[model samples]
Target: MRHRIKNSLALVGSIAVQTFRGDAPAGAAMPRFMERLKAIGRAQDVLTGDGEVSAQLRELVERALEPHRGGDCRRFRIEGPDLRLPEASATALAMALHELATNALKYGALSRDDGCVVVRWWVQADGSGGELRIEWREQGGPPVVSPARRGFGSGLVERALAAELHGRCVIAFEPAGVVCEIRAPLPRVAG
Candidate 1:
């Protein structure tokens, strides 16, 4: 029980630190911070649910993006096999997905009525072991250009994937939109 409480507190602390690190106006930042906090809470609920040792990847993705799916749910597409992820990996990946969805809403494809986002994932056999690859692609929004400096979201995605899931994350700002790809060893992601 103590361990669970500690973990929950740590998660909240991390969220608070990350959410307030920006210089955005309070009105703008408050809603985003609340959304992110809710995302983390949902992921924690999944992790702590009884009788389920692992979480469904699809479910995690949906939970992460739930807050962003407004009247036009059709703007987002998620395609992936019914893979199971360990608790830690699920939490990390869920957070990363939340960040991506937030960015999409703020600056990428989801920002426009005509824009859309496609999220896909697959598992493949590698020389060492099986690997999982996930991609987030946006289209029909404003043209994307690489940022002059990495922001908190980019750094969080890269570091979390690398440290927690032993994955490599690449963020590409293409002419059309933003694309994020993550590749991780299956064993690590599956725990």
Candidate 2:
């Protein structure tokens, strides 16, 4: 109980620190920061629940994208099997997904009325062990171009997948839209 409390406090402190460290005006930054904290809280809720040792992948994805769903949930298509992910991996993946959704809403498919996004995932067996591959594809948006430099969202997505879940993340800006793919070892990500 004490350990959990300590960890929770630490997480809150970290969020606060990150929130204030940004240069954006407080009026604009506060909302985005709060949204991110809420995302983390939802992931924590899933991780701490006693009903299951692992979290459902679909639930995590939904939670990550929920804030951005707006009134056009139909514009997003999410499909995957009932896969379970370990607490750490689930949290990391949730954060990554949030970044993707935020970017989409800001500049990609979700920004346009006719644009759409699709998220898909599957498990595959390799010589050593199985792997999970998640793909995020956006279409029907304005022409896409790679960013001149990586931003905080891109860095967070790449680093969290690599460091926290031992995964590889790739982001591509095709002329049509953007594509983000994440591949991670099943044993490590589904512990």
RMSD of each: 2.3, 2.4
Model 2 misplaced regions, further than 4 Å: 1-19, 188-191
Tell me, by TM-score, which candidate is best: 1
lDDT per residue for candidate 2 within 33-136, as digits (tens), equals 78777877888777677565468888888878888889778888999988888766776778778878889989999999888899999988898688888999
Worst 10 residues of 1 by lDDT: 45-54
Worst 10 residues of 2 by lDDT: 3-12
For candidate 1, give the lDDT of residue 56: 84
- Quantify all predictions' global Cα lDDT against the true fold: 0.81, 0.80
Reference-based TM-score, model 1: 0.88
Badly placed stretches (over 4 Å) of model 1 are: 25-28, 188-191
